[model samples]
Structure formats: C-alpha cells, structure tokens
Target: MKHVLLALDESDDRAVAQAETVRDLFDTEHTTAHLLHDFTDNFEGASVGQIAAVRHAANILEDAGIAVEYHETSGSPSTSIIEAADELDVDAITIAGRERSKAGKVLFGSVSQEVILGTDRPVLVCSRRTEE
Candidate 1:
C-alpha cells in the first residue's frame, strides 16, 4: 500500500471536483489521501497554508469516499510540501499544475518544478489538458 498526498491550495473549485479527480487517479483503498496546506505571514495576511484551508479541503476529500489525513503547516510552500511528503514517505505526490506566466515564472520561480526537481519520488501533476 502506498500513500498519495493531494496537495491543495486556495484555488477555485477544489472541493468535490479536485478530490474526486484525485480519487480516480489513485486507488483510495490502498492509498491514504494526505492534504496539506501552508499558511504564512505574507504581506496579505495568512494565506493558503492556513489550518482552516486545510480543514476545508480535507472535508471535501472525505466526502468523495477517500480516506484522508490533513495538516496545516508553517513554512515556505514548496519546502513544507516536500517535508510533508518526506514525513509520510508516500509513493508519489499529486499536485495541481499551473501554466506559469513568463513574469511569474521569473519572479516567484516554480513551486511544482522545485518539488519535482528536489524529490526522488514521482510527482503526478494534475492539469486539465494532461493525459492520465
């Protein structure tokens, strides 16, 4: 049995939609859906990593018949996400993929890229146009 973490953020329509999508992508029985959110003291107050957001996303995963363990962590988004994956020793990680704008890419760098390059585990990046 392997654990699969469904990384979530404040993105739109994640509730049932994203959870079900992940459930179908990975086996729920042999897998545990781990949801992690990071809340940091950014200039805009506490953000996606907040415990409340993680709790909200966890509820959605549960509704989809996926057994999930969720956590709210403090730290950089990519760093903490990788740490969570390491802690669980999951077989893989499933995260939403976004098309990075040139400017955005240059400034903040890429979270997905960072995670993908930093970890040895295979990362399944979910995108609308991506093929299973």
Candidate 2:
C-alpha cells in the first residue's frame, strides 16, 4: 500500500485541494493517508480531529475509499511535518501552498517551502482552487 503524509493547516479550501490531489494521484483503494496537523501556540492543546481542515480532508479521503490515520503535534509546522514524514516513512508528503507576496515570504518564511527543502522524500505541493 502507498502511504502519504498530508500536512494540513486551518484552511478548509486548502485541505480540500490537498485531499483531492492525493485521491487523484494515488490509487485510493491501495493508498493510506496519514493526516497531520501541527498545533502552534494559537492552537495549543488542540487535537488533530478538532481542526476543521483535518476533518474536511479526512472526509474527502475516506469518501474516496482511502484509509486514513490522524496525527497531531505541537511545534514548528515545517519541522513537525518533516519529522512526521520521516517517522511515518511515507511515500510522499503533501502540503497546501498559500498565496503570498515575495516580500511576505522573505519576511515570514514559508512552511511549504521549508518542507520542500528540508526533506529527502518526495513532496507534493497543492494550491487551493481559485474562483475564476
């Protein structure tokens, strides 16, 4: 079975995009998704299942017949995600990218970018669908 680590933030739209990407790119019947959510200070003590984004993504994947497991950690998002991927030994890591200005990215840094650079495993970056 193929294993994928889906790192989700709080955005429901982004969660949908990530879940859809996983469902589309892998064989749902044989794919197992490890849903991960990093609870920062703002979300301190929150459970992975308590997050809407995680619920949304879980529903999407489960509906697609993909097996799913929930994981939660509190720390740096990028670091936590990378560590989870390593510990889980997933086939790939999927994360949703948010629109940000170059200046913003330079100033605040990007979790997706950090995950892309920090891990040796394949990373799939998904962007939320924009309304036309």
TM-scores, all models, native as reference = 0.71, 0.89
lDDT of 1: 0.68
Worst 10 residues of 1 by lDDT: 12-21
- The whole-model lDDT of each prediction reads 0.68, 0.90
Q: Write the per-residue lDDT of candidate 2 for residues 68-125, one digit (tens) a residue.
A: 9999888899999999999999999998777679766553237878999999999998
Question: For candidate 1, lDDT tens digit of each residue in 66-112?
Answer: 67876657778888879999999988876766556877644433777
- Taking all chains together, the TM-score of candidate 1 against the true structure is 0.71
- Give candidate 1 regions above 4 Å deviation: 14-18, 42-60, 99-109, 129-132
Candidate 2, run of 10 with poorest lDDT: 102-111
